[model samples]
Target chain A: MTKAKVYHDGAVSGARRAVDAVMTVLLAALCIVWIYPVFLILINSLKAETAISTTSVFELPTAASFVGLGNYIYGITKLNFLSSFCYSLIITVTSVVLILLCCSMCGWYITRVPGIFSQAMYLLCVFSMVVPFQMVMFTLSKTADSLRLNTPFNIAIIYLGFGAGLAVFMFTGFMKSVPIAVEEAAMIDGCNALQIFFRIVFPILKPTMISTAILETMWVWNDYLLPTLVLDIKKYRTIPMAIQYFRGSYGKVEMGPMMACIMITVLPIIIMYLFCQKYIIEGVIAGAVKG
Target chain B: MEKAIKKYWPVFLLPTFAAFVIGFIWPFLWGIYLSFHKFVTVSKTTFVGLDNYFSVFSDPTFVSAFWFTAKFTIVSTILINVLAFALALMLTRGLKGTNVFRTVFFLPNLIGGIVLGYIWQILLNGILTNLGLPLLALDAKYGFWGLIILMCWQQIGYMMIIYIAGLQNVPGDLIEAASIDGATSMQTLFKVKLPMVMPSVTICTFLTLTNSFKLFDQNLSLTGGEPAKASQMLALNIYDTIFSRSGAQWKGIGQAKAVIFFLLVVAIALVQLYFTRRKEVQQ
Candidate 1:
């Protein structure tokens, strides 16, 4: 190549490098800003109550203000944090497992069976997707209470109904993409529908199952309004409801423990997220694309 | 196969169908019925016809909340999609440590909305106090922007993931053809990349639109519609009207508002999906 052509190429590549550098710096700055809130809570949780409220939150905790594990202890003991954590865990797991099993089966049935009833069922699940929880919150709670389905353990049934829409929709979409030849062959072997599903189809659906489980787990774990309204609040409180009630009961005086509780609530989810980051990202994409 | 499945319907579908009927269908039908009647609890109800609907329309707080939620939805939806798309573009540029940045940004979305709101409340209040400004709860405008900031933080990462997926799926041949045709980078982005990612745009828009309308936990914990309820959204308004209010009339009115809210969200989501889907290019 001529010298001029080589010089032109160098300049163009230099400009591209400049743009890349600028973007890296900008994204790095934004990440810090994005994580600042969680960091702020973490540091303040270690500070004394007076420091959290009286001093500017930007300051690092001093020897005088540091309370060590005092706030965590208070949160666990006085604030019922342990019970709420367990409740959140139990509720989220049960609801997700129930949603996966039921919705996958329902999705499989509707996809394979071509009839008016199946069509209507699929349509109803799609319709339920758009119905805001507010529309059914009040009456649903009352209904749950009347039927004795208001306990934390049993509320998974309620979530199954509420969450069935998206779960069924997603599962059905994936099911349609699954080749029918496999199922046909399994059927030809004299395998029952249940056996075929458990042995062949269920294993094939592992990816979508992970997607649905992650999506439902996030929703059931973080959900506040439904549990607040439906579950007997006196007897049961999820992490979000528990935190809100904790704040209300303590008012402003217990800011330290509140921060501690917030950290406690957030840490485990973050840890889980770090472990399953791939599935979470893929699950989101799968959910959004199908949704 | 059909006969076998039909025979096993009790095992395959009964549990879900039963739970759905009890959980969603019954409550939904009852809610629609309750919207037209006056009742405090469930048992005692008097037919009120259109009176509850009329009350919802006439209530000034409900009207203001409708506007607030509308404005908030529009602003946040636009901000989130744009920023998310931009970040998606940046992260897809073969940058080093892009994964780490993506993880950092996405961390917020994993946290619950209520916790996010309270965390932001403390942070924003501190900043405002340092600047000698009003607290987030003390003014509707601050509360509005505070909620916006919180939402943008929580959602941009999620929308970015979807957009990244969309961006990655864009055919390399199309981009190569554009560059070969001497298209400027700006032209290649706007004319080539943007149009190809319309599917992602459609999904993100739908998710953001519905989420912004149905938002409650964040609204409750962030502002609680303080300063005389100026910042209340539709969901929070319906909530307060139902649980916090007394008397039979308010309950009916709340149900009416909920039905209206449901219709509004459905209409908007449908329209959005239609328009965006039309723009999606067939691959």
Candidate 2:
């Protein structure tokens, strides 16, 4: 292994090293391209509303164009973006938590018990992942209203339903590889099934749970149409809904405050991602490959 | 273990199963049923077989939207995978600052589609204005290309991460063996590396295909089927059918279109997977 590795890396000639240097520069340039649009949004958020024009958009914000925290304040107070932020946080947290708990438990049942019902449940969860949201948008909205699931807290119940397919699929896939010996030993030790699951299986499933929570949180937080259809917008709005409503509701778009709201929506996620880069990336890889 | 665990089925499975029925199963079955009935609300309905489906075929906007989305899916899928694979290949070459570059590239994937749409709408239109071209919303072709560009920007890094993972798993000895056999770099890439990454190709294509087809929010924010709805996609078409218009017939037709849209996605996805899976080599 070391010989092969040395041939691939240490054996590289000076010319190859030069080529590597040039390639690194090219990759660095592409990184700038990836970041430019987000940077554009950030600078636009700081610019005065009137200063924003199609012609001057790409230019850096000038001293005259800059408005320090002005747009953020306007977005919070005037457009009531803070309430939308709170609602988004509440719904995402509750939904992700509910999905993790219920789906992980269901996955344990499906994996531990071999039976016809368990097989059917597993297949149904798998099938649900493929069905598009548009297929049931209208009917689901009506169902939510009928069931009184249109409120912020109750909507997590709705998310648990839609999110079950992915969450259960992930958990079950992870669980099948886990040995049954631990649970069997627990069962022999005068532990009932509930106690065994809560104490034994749940701890073993922590990595899968965290990854599932991240994936579901990403979806529920950014989801726009589901909330718009199910929730009464007059009462509750997610961050995406608020941004869309902010744009179309005004006769002329409030570009500055709108951009500020976008910044608020994106910053927390970026911060979380940068902090937990390893887990988030691993979660994504595990999800795509495993599924 | 199986018998003992089965005794606690209600405790373990009941909550998720119940929510699944409420959230997905019932709404899905009812939505299909609604497609056949002419009703403003679920309470009042008249059974009308095949009438709404026929109207769906005749509607100019719906027909055009289908073609537009099909074309968009193909172009974006091919571009996204190719560019992402290229980036992955470059980044895996023991380059300096690869981590920083990877983080930056993957940044946009974490942002929501709606936010992505607004960011690009401003930047793309500004570039168009500078170049003395018509706005993106004004022309059908511009709207098509604009969406393709935006999607590639957001999804390439995501697909790149997948591709990178796949590429790193390729046995290094295989590549060295190819080099020892006097194979050219291109030959080694095609014969050795490419086949090894077929699994990633299947995954990336599946993802890009479904995502582009099911896309709604970005299509809504960007262009929004402007220039008289010339650039509308299938999802946006289904949405506008029910909500943008107010009538019993339109709702029925919208439901019908949605059913068709779902089947199209499922069929295409299955076919893509079948062919791609056949090509994937087992390790």
Give the distance in Å from residue A160's predicted Cα in candidate 1 to where it truly belongs: 0.6
Q: By DockQ thresholds, what CAPRI class is model 2?
A: medium
- Could you report the Cα RMSD, in angstroms, for every candidate shown? 2.5, 1.6
lDDT tens per residue, model 2, A1-291: 122334444555566688879989999988888888889989989999999988888888899999999999999999889999999999999999999999999999988887898999999998888889989999999999999999888899999999999999999999999988988898899898899999999999999987888789889989999999999999898899998887778498888998899999899989999999898888888899976
Each model's backbone clash number: 0, 0
Candidate achieving the largest DockQ: 2
Candidate 2 chain A weakest lDDT stretch, 10 residues: A1-10
**Proportion of the native interface contacts kept in model 1:** 0.72
* Candidate 2 lDDT by residue in tens digits, B118-155: 88898899899989899888998888999999999989
Pairs that clash in candidate 2 = none
Q: Candidates' TM-scores?
A: 0.97, 0.97
Candidate 1 residue-wise lDDT, B243-275, digit = tens: 898776999999999999999988998899899
Candidate 2 off by > 4 Å: A1-12
